[model samples]
Target chain A: MRVSVIATAGNIAGEALSNKSVVMFDILRASSTISTALANGCKEVIPVIDVEDAFALARQLPEGSFILGGERGAIKVTGFHLGNSPLEYTASVVKDKTVIISTTNGTKAIRYAAGENGRVFIGSLLNCSSVAKALADLSKDIVLVCAGTRGKFSLEDTLAAGLVIKDLLKFFNKNPWQAKTQEHNKFYLEETPIFNNDALILEDAAVAALRLAEYYWQSPIQGLLDSLHGQKLLQLGLAADLDYCSKLNHLTNVPVFFNDKIL
Target chain B: MRVSVIATAGNIAGEALSNKSVVMFDILRASSTISTALANGCKEVIPVIDVEDAFALARQLPEGSFILGGERGAIKVTGFHLGNSPLEYTASVVKDKTVIISTTNGTKAIRYAAGENGRVFIGSLLNCSSVAKALADLSKDIVLVCAGTRGKFSLEDTLAAGLVIKDLLKFFNKNPWQAKTQEHNKFYLEETPIFNNDALILEDAAVAALRLAEYYWQSPIQGLLDSLHGQKLLQLGLAADLDYCSKLNHLTNVPVFFNDKIL
Candidate 1:
């Protein structure tokens, strides 16, 4: 298996993405929010690129069927029902509701991945293990897309990506491919067919992420606190949000982007 | 001052690069090769992207005035005088002669930086301290361009870039900006005017490099040996070359791309 981590969504090569499965990490919020909403029983999360588009999509849905969500400059958009905070998404609030979301970085990456990749999976610190398990099961060439802050690399996303890579290595080491294929045929036909994991090769970007994860494995929150977006969120009194996003492998749901929605 | 480390030459934004002092790093071994040639009394090194262009430029130069040098798949060009090996460039061989070089990655980044940046500098393990000193003197925004393996991030160049950024941080901590501006007036007026380094800000890409540097500080060679390009070089019995490229702050000559030549 070959894995590549794109440092930022801005420079993603569209042609290269189509053949590979993409897992996007916007650990500061978007990925976390979507994952949480889905875990809490949201029917689907529609990631739109623009706030206007989110509004338009919401208007088309029945009044109680959807909730307007997302952020601009780390704050909830005016008239939106919820902000881009995973903590804001509760089981009672998101149950069977559709989330129409737009965010500064994550949604753009999600949309790009949606258009370019056949399999677009959402990941964050909250659900990285689950994400890794799903990817390793497919055993296809994968690309981890980091929805970087304003077209620049974000440390938070890279850390989450590293964690996923770390977990993937563990899974590959513990389970033989022959064993995995027989047991996990759940999405084999619809998505990628299983391939033997004889060797796992990580590209340079992925290597960097894995190294960061190893370095900060002792105290991952410190790394998040040191990130550009994390610092901005801290300044905006969203330390709790950062804390929420930093929880590792706490969620079991993998919100996969299929047919223009994350479910 | 703000600093950014571009993971690869492929995704460099032209507009952002123009105002920043771009430092190109191709650790194994274009940057190291150029630094060695310059330190050994070469007149100049002209970096061209294509082998055909290198041949065309060499043809234009008077015979014996310049030597055609560079590599394709880590080997010297068929008709060139030297390969992309720093060890090949010694005082007796290259003194008082011009080097027209082309490489798989390094030269392309050099050409792009030359076209876009007002000031283009070369860096590697051999001359990272020199590069950092020169950048600190300028006291302007900087973009550390890592000429990655093949349109992807290379760990060797990232580690080198990290070493430079680490040194830059040291320079800021040890000396006041006002003092630096007084002593280094050589390229101040012609290029970027010195600014106060009261609080040097590093972009996220730079932060990643710095973290890598900190992680590998005790065993820098191990990091290089672990890189994809480094492994390939080792397989070809270029272990000595990797060891040579891993030397930190061994060279004093800072190669600057000025008026079409790295001098």
Candidate 2:
């Protein structure tokens, strides 16, 4: 299957993502937070584009049934129940509650990708392999959308995308189908997956992302600490969030965003 | 000596490139062609933002003293003297003649960068080291502007920027300053180059560009041939131009664009 990657959500147009499976990555915090909340038994997550929308959605829900969780400029929004840190999204806090969230970058990306009629999956280093396996099972063309920081390229998001693409490639490589011969001694093709030599096109951004992943694969935490946004978060006293987001394959829910909620 | 990279010209605002040394990279053809023409003894190359401006500038010049050279959609402009290929800019044709040029992407980038009061330099793989040396000698903050194809990221331009940054780092690494001792057995500091530790900050895009250059340092030609733009040129039967642009440090003339002319 062909896989393409966009370095930021601002680079995507509505028509480009039509009829494709899209995986949104914001590994610095948002995607990881969403995956953690879902994996911890949160009923659902409503990702709104703005803080006003989050408050309005929360008000509409039954009292005490939903919590407002979001951040602005890497800090918890005024009057919000929780910030974007995945550490705060534990089972004891988020269990059986619907979360109406608004983030600076990640939720906006989800809203943008939700414009097209495609299956939208939340992806991060926490559930990269699970997301890759889910996409492979669909056997459709995939587009990895990186929720970069405020319309600019972010290293963490791009590296997470690269990891997803690399995992997909490895999955296909190790699970190649084998052909069997019949009693009549006639050669026949077995039921194989979609494998076209020319169909697997790699865009320039995708290649760059893959290279970035390879370069920092051995020390992802240190790589995150060295990134531009990572440094900003460090200045904001969010080192624990960085360490939490650095874990690979720590979650397996493979959260999917559908009908304004991540399930 | 901070270095920041913009993946595409669209990301740049009016104030972003002000008071900096701006190096524009369109390695596939436009910047390469401009450097080649200047190196081949052309009087000057005027980069215009539109084809109409190119034609107007040519008409204003004395007859037989100038030539209109440009391309639209990878093909030579109608009735122009040359296309956007460096191979077409030989000494015999462009020597002592003013070239009024416009391309689909490169000239637009030059125009955008020229809006601010920065020193604009035309850069490509052909003159990467020369451009890096020139910037290092100036000791001003550098901004590498990639002339991405039609508002999208192009691989060749980013890789070329990375090469320039890599060379500049090497130049500084090898030429460290030495202190002198006075007659009274006291040490005196020499006039060293700008060496502030925090001043040489690398943005995320700049770091990515550096990593890309390191990944493809050994096989630059193959790297170019494998780029998205390179594949398009091959389809258009312009592989020869790709070969010409792939040569690293082959030209020493660092063509600087000032006052509407590349000299």
- Which is the leading candidate under lDDT? 1
Q: TM-score of each candidate?
A: 0.88, 0.86
TM-score of 1: 0.88
Judge candidate 2 against the unseen true structure and give its global Cα lDDT, from 0 to 1.
Answer: 0.79
DockQ top scorer? 1
What is model 2's interface RMSD? 13.5
Over 4 Å off, model 2: A60-64, A171-197, B171-197
Candidate 1 per-residue C-alpha lDDT over A1-263 given as tens digits, one digit per residue, 9 for 90 to 100: 88889878877778878767789888889998999999888888988888888888888999899988999999999999999998888989989999999998898888776655556999999888898999988878889999899888898899999889888988666331222224222222222112222467777677778878876665566666657777678668777787777778889998888878888
After superposition on all C-alphas, the RMSD of every candidate to the true structure, in Å, is 9.6, 9.2
The global C-alpha lDDT for each of the candidates, from Candidate 1 onward, is: 0.80, 0.79
* Candidate 2 per-residue lDDT over residues A226-261, each given as its tens digit: 467887786687777877888888888898898778
Residue pairs with colliding backbones in model 2 are none
Which candidate's TM-score is highest?
Answer: 1
Residue A126 in model 1: shift from native, Å?
Answer: 0.7
